[model samples]
Target: MDIRPTDRPDRRTFAIISHPDAGKTTLTEKLLLFGGAIRAAGEVKARGAARRARSDWMKIEQQRGISVTSSVMTFERDGLTFNLLDTPGHEDFSEDTYRTLTAVDSAVMVIDAARGIEAQTRKLFEVCRMRSVPIITFVNKVDREGREPFALLDEIADQLALDVSPMNWPIGMGGQFEGLYDLEHDRLMRPAADNARGFEGDVEQLGGMDDAKLATLISSQGLALLREEAELAQAGYAPFDDTAYRHGDLTPVYFGSALKDFGVAELIDALARFAPSPRPQPADPAPISPDDANVTGFIFKVQANMNPMHRDRVAFMRLCSGKFRRGMKLNQMGTGKAIAVHSPILFFAREREVADEAFPGDIIGIPNHGTLRVGDTLTDGPPVTITGLPNFAPEILRRVALKDPTKTKQLRKALDDLAEEGIIQVFYPSIGGQWIVGVVGQLQLEVLISRLEVEYKVDAVLEPSPWDTARWISAATPEELKAFTDLHRGALAEDRDGAPVFMARDTWELGYVSDRNRAIRFSATKERN
Candidate 1:
């Protein structure tokens, strides 16, 4: 068997998403441990001596114990390259997670067993459903007392409106938590001891439902319940359908306790076996194939400063097809100019290293300087634009000012870079000069301010703006756009990308503008042009 990264069949690129405090980060760490990417799993909230999660590399995340940005982690296990995108679970950072989802072929949804489906998880799931991205569900934190497995499954089915297939069944719960029974293979996996870590404490595997030891691990009543549920699940309550799963209609659910490191390996193994590889990406002329000979990829995310000391910018590109080699010349689809990729960087959270070559389904970062923007595609073949990246309207509007007037250039540069990363939207008044920053939530504004001070050594302040919502304006021709801009000059602005936007004080004002300017179209969400 050929074991190379270019072997597309062995590649698995997926994102892990969940609500805040759903143990998503913990699950990511355990997956890394099983993949041998890290020596030991790091706790999300380390007490006295334990270390923090490796994926949550930002200082703000460590202090707050919440992921504020998405991190890409690549690890090779069992001759497969698993590009795992660990996304922020906080609602404030949902935009970042949404963008990350566009780059993967599948998604692993981590749901809290006690909480079931959460607001943030549902929002992320909707995005996955929109893209037809296959989803694998993992109910985390089953070690503690929580909702019944059947109830949780039903809740997911009803709320998310998707078929739920139980791949494995939990033996017991809370204090009596023993292990899980694999429904696919009909085997019982019992942990040797409680609170085992890093695949420690030999896992006792019992084959055959009639095994005598099964009665000893689980009570007679508990055993009866497991048998009944397994039978119902296997009989047809939730049968695994590959076509349905690939079409985002079915989700294979697994029960696990990420904190104790149980069931993590099984989940990883299932992903390797079933997760889709780099699929055809939607592009301008048509969808691009991963098997295409020409190298192609798109910039889904951009980070202003990964290393606070260097003051650098990185444009994260997901290789869609063919192979990428350092120093190869590729055309920037946005500009239609040939550019050489000098330093192709690969990431493991905050840490990074230069890579010589990469293949489809792999994510490689290129050190950029105002050259790369989000949604910009690069290819060795014909120029084509990758579609489906949505830019949501900002909910909070504010006017920003730099404390030091002499650092105006630095401040403007910093804001431009941050805006490119989608942290905030920088808008300029129709009359020009003054800049306004708009964000989906307050946390985004906070992150922008923090990054300016930490990365660019510039202090900034934001004053609240009366406008509550923003929309990009589109028209049939340039004349119509100018006419509408002139008509609504006071409410008109230009986004960082130079797209015309209308700032409305309220929904009524927005409606008035739409009613007044019938020629112009107001879009709350705009896709990459």
Candidate 2:
């Protein structure tokens, strides 16, 4: 398989998403092993439970045993490169899952046969639908007792609202689980009993029970079945394409036990035949202008590492387009100030670094590029702004006050860095000079508090941020109304308590461009004739 950065490389990009403990990580490890991405699969050993999907990057994720961030990996299978993204299943990190769906072209919605379609599964499925990313269903954990494959599929179809069909069916579930009947092939293969891979069942009796499905499988025949599954596998899932299903261009459903490695070969065959490579769509002309001489990319994430030489701030960037190399002069998207690009780009393998020249769709890390913020597009072309990235509005709000006066400076710096990292937003209200912040949930607040005391030596007390309203004053004269409108050019007016309320630039939008050196200043001064 060619893993080169070509316009139409034979690559399949898909994300594996499911509710926590639905065996998503387990299934992911099996898939990766089958695809030859990893030599041996490792399990995420939590307090007592062993979670498999949590890939390398053992920070807070190990203790929690739930993926807090999305991890990217690529594997080769039968002349195709599968670029798989494993996303967090917990609701606390739903925003991370939402953004990841935007980056992938397809997804595998892993459903626990025992649990069926769950709250997180439904929520993630909705995000994929909203992004028009097609999904393939993998009903996992059939080896476990009470895991009903058929019932779970029906539940998923009902809850997720999809026209569901089965590509393969489990022959026997639990201890009786030998393997699976490949409905398309009309044949069965016994899983290596000792090895125990996922979705594998001993194809004890192929033409056994379900006569109708058996007849259909027989009619399709060996060669025809291969061709049909091959065609569907090649198409991958296109969330927006209705014709995909009509023509069997998307993988319908595949069943297996991720733990036992049941039906791994069959699963491999399906991925090789169906998973898309460089899936195409309506093309928009390249945004990079011809005359633009500088390399342009956008920062997606940041990591603050404490190394011996220099406690570096590593930035994760996506080179959307254009050629960027070391020592290139470029401007940050929002600020429009010239900044120098330095160092060879690095890729994250667990926590280790591998240097490479990045292309579009490649995620790389940069060092020593100060004041660069998330969503800041760097370009040598005409100054441009790229906004509307998936940012969850702060649903849970809280505040932390400094305990020691001496650590105020350190606490303030930590808060500023957290805001820049897209983890939290700092707010200062008029009532009390107390520091307030907002984040997705309480765990994030806990992490912030710990980091302040342990990492920065800044002890603080956290409290829920209080909501306060400010009084608005307006003059009765026409001149005053005109003056107010001019002062707030981009102001929005809405009814509040039976009176018109006007709001200016929101603090939420400000976080997107937190790296700006100085705020953009504009004036509306007119000379009196």
Question: Which prediction has the highest TM-score against the true structure?
Answer: 1
lDDT of each: 0.85, 0.57
Kindly list the per-residue Cα lDDT of model 2 for residues 264-365, writing each as its tens digit: 556666555555433332112344331233455566565554232455666666554455556667787657787765664543234333443444444556
Q: Which stretches of candidate 2 lie over 4 Å from their true place?
A: 1-6, 43-58, 76-80, 185-187, 194-251, 263-297, 306-310, 321-331, 337-349, 368-370, 380-387, 453-457, 468-529
* Model 1 TM-score, 2 decimals: 0.94
Q: How displaced is residue 135 in candidate 1, in Å?
A: 0.6
For this target, which candidate reaches the highest lDDT against the unseen true structure?
A: 1
- Candidate 1, residue 398: lDDT: 91
**Per-model TM-score versus the true fold:** 0.94, 0.70
Worst 10 residues of 1 by lDDT: 43-52
